[model samples]
Target chain A: MSDPVISVAGIGKEYVLGVSMSGNMLREQIASGVRKIFQRVERPNRQQQRFWALKDVSFRVDQGEVVGVIGHNGAGKSTLLKVLSEITEPSTGEIRVRGRIASLLEVGTGFHPELSGRENIYLNGAILGMTRSEISRKFDEIVAFSGVERFLETPVKRFSSGMYVRLAFSVAAHLEPEILVIDEVLAVGDLEFQKRCLGKMGDVARSGRTVLFVSHNMTAIHDLCERSLLLNHGELVADGATGDVINGYLSGLNTDASIKRKVSNDADAWVTDVRLIYEGSESRQGFKMGQSLCVEISYETKKKVEHLGFGISIEDCIQSTRVFASVSSIHGIQLENVEGEGRARVCFPDLKLVPGRYMVTITLNAKSFQYDRLEGVRILDVLGQDELGTGWVLSRQRNGVVWLNHEWLLDGRQ
Target chain B: MSSAETTEMPERIIRPKTGLIGVNFRELWRFRELFFFLSWRDVLIRYKQTALGVLWVILQPLTSVVVFTVIFGKMANLDSHGTPYPLITLAALIPWQMFSNAVGASSLSLISSANLVTKIYFPRLIIPLSSTLGTLVDSLVGILLLFVFIFGYLFGREFGLIEVPVGVGLHWQLVLMPIFFAYALLAAIACGLWFSALNVQYRDVKYVIPFMLRIAMLVSPVGYLSSEIPENYRLLYSINPLVGVIDGFRWSVLGSEFQPYWPGFCLGATVVLFFLVTGVMFFRNTERKFADII
Candidate 1:
């Protein structure tokens, strides 16, 4: 390789939780020093909790390479990105970079609420390392991309949450650096704005700049990145082609077969457990586009509940949009004077959802009030497919939650 | 957007560093635009939505002068070396307010601007330095009101419409007033660098600052003259850096009627320079852990 654009060598970051409370104060620091003279302790910090967010990680990326970082919540993905972007210093090892770096971990890093949108655009741009002349040159383009031209003079405090996010994201999207580090910033804004943001990211990836992307959305990672790194806990566990790495991550998650969790213990009647039945078998990992999917729920009641109903909501985890929702009462099915233990199955014959991970929330409701509700109970993974007989496979960036049933005609007739 | 060869690009290595106590002048110079914007933002927000606005700058010292003129001049009958008590009190109060406002805000600046410090990487010194610079705008306005008050009162006396005592001499000494004001700013920044760096670690430093400034006000010659201090206690009083500032202002404005105490002023200057050199070194050494702790 012709000189990697970014190189890291055995980097490790350790954090001491609630550390040096005694050292923070002058009196406490002095007192601790006096005691240390008398007591011969091996370690002065025996009580402080030391957590290694990242340990002994080494990687290198060449010029124009786009690498994806995939891991679970505490897999050290963010810590690695932070060390690369210079937001925090690592406890051990070192990093070398040959190009200018700009990382976008959060949108609108230094936005002031009291300032007008026009003033904030400049301030936020400057905070992100843009010179004044550069901001002035792109000021018009930034405003137009945000679609908030009419309210540019108004304070951002009065903006709707959607408008605020769009304006903030617009300023960040225009930054052009030799190396870009992004961390899950696409999980925001409305569906239309999200589509535009994805389009902008495509333009960035095609421009041949080195990118290090960290995200939980597998589809986005698979579609954009050619190489991937998988982290488990604080160590680098896997690194190779994107498709193989994703398979390793998914299989790692499949080790746990139970797809049920107890949400709360407050209600008189509650759901005991839940599982997905696919293709006449109990499976949480076997799902695809255009297949019959069933959600089976088991419940117990303290007293007999009249006209009991079970509700289910399928929400898009990537886009955070609700795809489908229904209750047994709405479909004219109910159990009268339900008692003891029982099972209910809700099935969709032709599941038209696009290929992506989704969250399932189940609730138990009587005629008067809700007995118990379980939110984000289980994650349902649907594998990508080519149902349309073309080269287009499903991903979060290119598709919505559900595919429409419309057809296109060459003429006015179909 | 150019796809040039990567060989020419400047390379940087990031690692945990120790014993880097000296300031990097080139890095601070490179981020000068950020400094200007931060200081401008503070000045804009300080007077935002207030009715009096910049008027409050002039009004603050004027009201203090009235109270001291009556209490110290009319009741105690303290010596002013033939100059009017009100004129001398205004000169001293001007520097006192400037010192207090700059030091107080700049000391808490790093804690208040925690969002910027934790998110971005620049010279962390910019936050405290910008806040200290923002108060200079108010100082400029106060100096204008001082000149107008002196000239307007003398004009009325010239016309014989009002009876007032003349205490100011329009001489070459007046041109040196900016030097004293600049010296007062150095004192504030010197103390602010120490307190603000400490404030990031121990949050109780926030509560200790206001109480410390209150004690500072009593020790300096704000409402009283440094000349009136007893001979036995004079040495102890001269250790206060602001005693030199107030004395310099009174000398500059009141001319030969009041002379600056050179031995005490020289001692105070020496102490401030010592604090400044040590404070910069301490702040630079401790800044590496700021992001993790804050």
Candidate 2:
């Protein structure tokens, strides 16, 4: 194998905390300078603290490797990309990069709102390190891909945000830089454009170009990257094949389930506890298809709220797809009066969900006002069941997400 | 677009380095297209909707000359070295307008493009440099108008429509106009680099620029000639740098009796060089923090 295109060793980035305050910075600096001169010795303020955005982050990407960086907010994913892009210097260690690099920190960077779409194509192309002739070479393709040909001469300020993102991404994707560093810019634009972006990214990866992609969207990461890295609190916790890393991240989330909030707004109602309980057991695990499953919610209301009802929404954790939603009010089963502390339980006699991890969101509300809402408050892991009597697990690979009760009759007359 | 052998491409090490040796020339050269586009964007946006698009460029210096001619020439009767006051003042206003507008916009360049700085990975110097170039176009227009006035005054005096008592003629020193203009731009860039870097960290620098320019206008030889200063303090006064530009500018275009004072011009040039070297050093030192802080 050839030498790695990008190599980073012991890279650390440190930021001084709480230095930015909303005021005239010159006056503050002048006052500080004067104080230092008078004192003859400057000391760091007590309120100041040191934050390490990245610590000992070591990685190497061989030529033409597509790697996905997955992490939650404040997990140093952005700092890592910034360090690689050389937008900011690392406080410690070294990074060696080969070939031309184009980094897309956002869509439509360096685009002037007053300039027309045709003009912005050239401007944004140049900002991404594309030469003038190179932009003209791909000009027609970019316009066609963006689907903004009708408004090509109109100023970008007049274009819808979706059109703006489409044009920007089209120009960026046409760039032929050897190495591409992209942040979560795909989060913008419509679903169709997002699909096109993914397709284009896949083509770039297939063309033997190195790519460093950072995103919170797990499905995209799984689709485009064969290798993945997991970051937690500025540390590289895992690096392996995409499946293992995603599994490591998802199961890691299971331990932090049952999120509770102390919302003081109105204080009408708030959830205190939320969990999925297996039938006849306090264990929170071992949920199975076609098994009795119960979702228990403990909440409190400072004042009596009429028509109080509990709602639950189930979402597919991996794809973030909403699977089902049901509310007591919609079922015409609202409580006449609810006050103080109480426990509410919703039981499914035969849970029809296929085997997968699902996220549950609970909401407490009345007729007109929403008291509180908590999303992803709990995780339900459903195990596959053999409800079809096929001697094998009833899995989504065969039966889809839910099981249906149906009878099958076969007549053998031959 | 050439599919050349990859062996020809140079590898870069992105280690943190200190001091003046840290500039990446190859990277800057590769992004030259961006530099041009950014400058072009600024120039195009400035006059997009104005009814008299490029005319505003000439209009600014012309109106300023009229105002200075009325107040400084008619009311105050400030000395103009025996040349037409309008000719001499307009000659200096070309470079002065260029310097003021360039420095004004360049200093605020980084602050205004905070989005680009924090989000992208191009050289931060491009912002100020492109803005300076954008304003250079305006200065060129001002220069064109200065010549029109000089010839107009010559013809108008012959026709008895002008009352100025001095001859308006070009001199051999006009060959040095490019040198003088270069100095003006150098001075602007020097201050621009310093103030643009400072503006990122201290936003009050933006407010300080206009106030500082007003004071600068009074102290520099914008409306009046450097000869009016007492002989003893001429060297001290010429240290302002714009004094040398104005002095050399009038001498070059108006064919005035005032010659280029070598000592003051040299002193001013040295001061401008000092600002250039120090401004670049300081800007490079603080640029890495711009993305984080901004």
Best by lDDT: 2
What value does the lDDT take at residue B196 in candidate 2? 96
What are the DockQ scores of the candidates, in order? 0.49, 0.45
The candidate scoring highest on TM-score is: 2
Residue A198, candidate 1: alpha-carbon lDDT? 77
How good is the docking of model 2, as DockQ? 0.45
lDDT of 1 by residue, B1-294 (tens): 344746568788988776666998997997788887788778877886689988888888888889999988889888877667878888888888888889898989997888777677778898889998888888788778788878876887799976766566475778888899888988998999999999989877888989999999888988788988987777678899999998998788878767778889998999899998998988998887777776
Per-residue lDDT of candidate 2, residues A267-325 (tens digit): 57888878788865475855878888888888888877776888999877776668899
Chain A TM-scores, one per candidate? 0.66, 0.71
> In candidate 1, what are the lDDT values of residues A1-414, reduced to their tens digit?
367888888899998875473346766767778978987865746547688999999989988888999976678998888888777889998899988788888787778777789988988887777788888999999999999999998888899989999999999889887888988888789879977987888788888988899887776888789999999878998989999998887666443556444535446688887788887766665588888889988888877777689999987654455778999999888789988888899987778888877778888888878887766566788888788889789776677678878887779654
Off by over 4 Å in 2: A20-24, A30-46, A256-316, A319-414, B1-4, B19-22, B157-167
TM-score of every model versus the real structure: 0.80, 0.83
Residue A193 lDDT in candidate 2: 90
